[model samples]
Target: MNLGDLAYPDVPTDAVHLLPLGATEPHGPHGPLSTDTIISVGICERAAERLEGEIPVLVLPAVAYGVTRYGSAFAGAVSISEETLRSLVGEIAEAVGALVLVNSHFEPEQVETLRSTGLPLLDLTRRRNAERLTEEFRAGSCHAGRYETSLVLAERPELVHADRMTALEERRVDMPAAIRAGRTDFVAMGMEQAYCGAPGEASAEEGSETFETLATMLVELIREVAA
Candidate 1:
């Protein structure tokens, strides 16, 4: 049951409560700042659809703000502290029967905050065939690249500017190296527009395939955690 549709939740006692997390951060010159939220929601929605007859789930409204201190210096980025996100997620999880966290933003501090919640969160960023997808991208960078841009194309096409999503392959930057080097914004990493990886190669079909893999992982996670 969708929580938003109810005046009072008529949720089944055994239903899983999935909280999708997103961030108001820059993706690239062509991608919207809400890319995190949009893709997270699409992943959650597909996962829920996959589990429809197996275990009922309530997909909660997404948390649109998060700790992105590493990218905070970018024009379209906004970040909160890890402590703030931890506190909020913990408090919210307390009210659910079975809880799962679905997030797309992979910032170090944000990921650490979510894991430290000690609340059995389900994040597909590190799981799923996520490794394979990231490996397919340039030096494992996913931000505003083919992977993410494809996801947005599949989920919310209007938000992606196809014309601008071109030739970002030239701007390959190793995000992990940048993080290790303590650089915050894209400009510092030789990516002036805050995007990384190949965008010209992104297609809606690829996005659909990515979600199929991620949603399968989600299903496995829910079964394990809810066991």
Candidate 2:
């Protein structure tokens, strides 16, 4: 159930609250800046539907911003301190006992910040389904690439700027090593164009299938945990 659609009395105070977290950052030239949020919400929606009558699940309003300092290039990226993110998540979880987290942003720092929440966080980025997609998408660069672009196509096709696909496939950079090497921005990591991976190969069908796989994985996890 959507929290916004319910009155205070109708709110499921005792239900399991699920929170989707995303980053308002650059998602390459072909994808939307809100790609992360779109994917997060999409997964949450599917998971909720799968568990409809089985569990009391409440889909909370998505957190539109996150700790993604790595995408500081080509505009649209915003970030907050790790402490700030932690506190914000903590405050939300405090009110509902615990908030099950679902996130689409894969930046190392952002993932670290979310993990630091000390709450139950189900990160799909590193899951088996995502691992397989990484092979197909060559997503080691960890930015707007085939995987993310396809996800956007599945969630919001109109948001995709198809005219800008594959312009920087050859310039894809390895972000994790760059961060470890003391580099601070996307420009330093070789993402001068603000995206990586084979976005040109992304298709809505691939995206839709990937989403179903992820949602299935999430539902199974929630069932295991809830059991």
Candidate 3:
């Protein structure tokens, strides 16, 4: 359900507060601009449903904007600074104990800042490595690519554009090397297309599988942390 349903006049000693952090940015021509937020909220809702009344996970309002520097070259890619994100997360952490942050956009610095709060935090970005799924899908890229495309297709089919799948050749750089140099330098290594992997290969079936696996993993993590 909704946030109003989980309202507690005072401290919600009986339930776990789920703050779903999301982003309102472009996902490419094939996906919606609110793809990140939509996916995050959807996953949180599913997890809440699975847990049922035991945990009483409350769905807080999602943060619609995030630090999306890499995707800035693309249209409709609005982002905030790491400091701002940190402040937002920290404030929320001060009010809650266990937080399941369902993040979609990549912002390592902000996430690190939030993690420093020492509250029970669940970072979904680094939760599950997509290497296995990437190889399994034969997706040449990662961002807005096959995996993401498939995810959107499975989660929100009406948002995907199956007919606009066009192959765009770009140079691929090693992630470890980019990390060593830093994010600014990493931005110079790729095209301005706001994508790296193969979004053309995305399908509803693949999206469904990927999302299901992720949701399952999140459920387990939440239970573990709450215990």
Candidate 4:
């Protein structure tokens, strides 16, 4: 449901507030810049549909900005400090009795911060639980890859640039390796285009399947938390 719909006074108090957080940044030339937010909203809306009136799941306005330092090298990428991201998420969680974070980006530091907020955070990072779904969809790589491209194609087909996929390159960086070496050298990792994986393989059908599975998983997690 829309955020405006939640403003009704008769709305139930025990409803689980679902906050879809995302970033407004580049996701390769094939995908939309707001891919993260779009994916999050799609999944949240699907989950809310399944829960219906009985679950009182409300879709809050998505956090359109996120921490994207590595991608900042790209022209359209914008990022915030880890502290700012954490504080912002914490404030939102405190405002609601319980929060189900629908995250599309794989920012570990930001995820950890949101988790530490003590809210019922549901991790949907490509590097985490979403990895399995990625495999199922044959979506390779982690960023602006087959999975993300497919999801965007499924949810917002008009926004994708399928013909440009062949020009994009796969640039995978081992974040853990850099972290262990005490070097904040994300730019030097060779991800100049801020992209990884094959965007050309994305399809609307595959995207729909991945979205359905993710929505189901999120709803199940919410039910467990409520119980």
Candidate 1 at 139: error in angstroms?
3.3
Question: Where does candidate 2 have its weakest 10-residue lDDT segment?
Answer: 130-139
Worst 10 residues of 3 by lDDT: 132-141
Query: Over the stretch 1-227, how does candidate 2's per-residue lDDT look in tens digits?
Result: 88867899998756777888898988777778889999989888899898988987888999999888767656787887788888888899987774688888877777888888767777755656466454644346647777778888898999998888745464566665677899887777777778766788788898898888778877876776677
CA RMSD per model (angstroms): 1.9, 2.0, 3.4, 2.8
For model 1, how does the per-residue alpha-carbon lDDT over 11-119 read when each residue is reduced to its tens digit? Answer: 5777888888999998887899999888888878888888889888878889999988656667867888887898889888887757888888888788888988876
Candidate lDDT (C-alpha), each: 0.80, 0.78, 0.65, 0.75
Better of 1 and 2 by lDDT: 1
The window of 10 residues in a row where model 4 has the poorest summed lDDT is 134-143
TM-score of 4: 0.86
2 versus 3: better TM-score goes to: 2
Candidate 2 Cα outliers beyond 4 Å, as residue runs = 125-132, 136-139, 166-170
Prediction-by-prediction clash tally: 0, 0, 4, 0
> Best by TM-score, which number?
1
Better of 3 and 4 by TM-score: 4
By lDDT, the better pick of 2 and 4 is 2
> Candidate 2 or 4, higher TM-score?
2
Candidate ranking (TM-score, best to worst)? 1, 2, 4, 3
Give candidate 4 regions above 4 Å deviation: 125-128, 136-140, 169-187
Cα lDDT tens digits, model 3, 33-144, are 7777776776777888888877767677888888766666667877788788878877886776567676766556556665765655556545254443445233333556
State the number of backbone clashes in model 1: 0
